[model samples]
Target: MFLLKTLTILVAIVVIIGAVTLASKKAVHHDGLEIEDLNKRYRMMANAVKQAVMKKEAWKKEAKAEKIRAKGDDRSDTKPIAFVIDFKGDLKASAAASLREEVSTVLEVARPDDKVVVRLENYGGVVHEHGLAASQLSRVRER
Candidate 1:
């Protein structure tokens, strides 16, 4: 009976540890903003510029010119977009998975004129890890 009780205790401990381990594991997070959102942000900035110009009485006439410039002559065409991704590599290059997912997401909606910029920081680590990171970046170039 003592042996059975010990085994039951051991199983219970193992189950508790397993549950804690799973709970502690971090989930990967990925997010991106669309170009249209960026354009809206730019428009807001332009409006702010107009507001500043209005405050300066001397620049009142220039305010109209500024507004016309801010509206941009190219309004008839879609502005080219750029997607930026930042990666910090460790010895395991675990960020490669996230990079791949982000790149794939961007590619789905990216136009031929769009750009992808990956800002990477690495102190150099395992060869395979770096290679995997490079491969992930190459996928961006392929698109």
Candidate 2:
């Protein structure tokens, strides 16, 4: 009887911890932005492609990439900066909170000509969660 009681208590404890973990996972994460240089990444990828291909083909690819890279790099006063943000939404849309922060951060530094690019990956999810996620994104235009 004592052993059975102890096992029951342990099971209860485990259940409580599991519930708390799930709740926290679904909660809004306050972690800040993860910034990356798209242009630098592109340059790195271009170099990789150039190295993989034959010399002549690599030159051709590099030439094309160079043109694209130049256009990206030569930012005049009037030219806009592209703020690219990637969001992978789960069923709970827990990432919506972080995305809100990202949009706000971009908006803070945004110029008149600046634009935002959100690469969202959401197959399907709870209706309310999706709606919340969409609202968070719409904040960009509303502001």
Q: Which ten residues in a row have the lowest lDDT in candidate 2?
A: 28-37
**Model 2 lDDT at residue 137:** 80
Candidate 1 TM-score, true structure as reference: 0.53
Candidate 2 stretches greater than 4 Å from native: 1-30, 54-77
lDDT score, candidate 2, position 2: 100
Query: What would the per-residue lDDT of candidate 1 be over residues 1-143, giving only the tens digit for each residue?
Result: 99999999999999999988887774533355333466668867976777676667645766677668867866543777777777888877777767777777888988888898887887777888778778877877887
TM-score of each: 0.53, 0.59
> Please, what are the lDDT tens digits per residue for candidate 2 over residues 15-125?
999999999989966566777888789978967787677597768777887778778985567877888899998877777777777887898998877888889898777
lDDT of each: 0.76, 0.82
Superposed by TM-score, candidate 1 places the C-alpha of residue 72 at a distance from the truth, in angstroms, of: 7.3
After aligning candidate 2 to the native by TM-score, how far in Å is the CA of 130 from where it should be?
A: 2.2
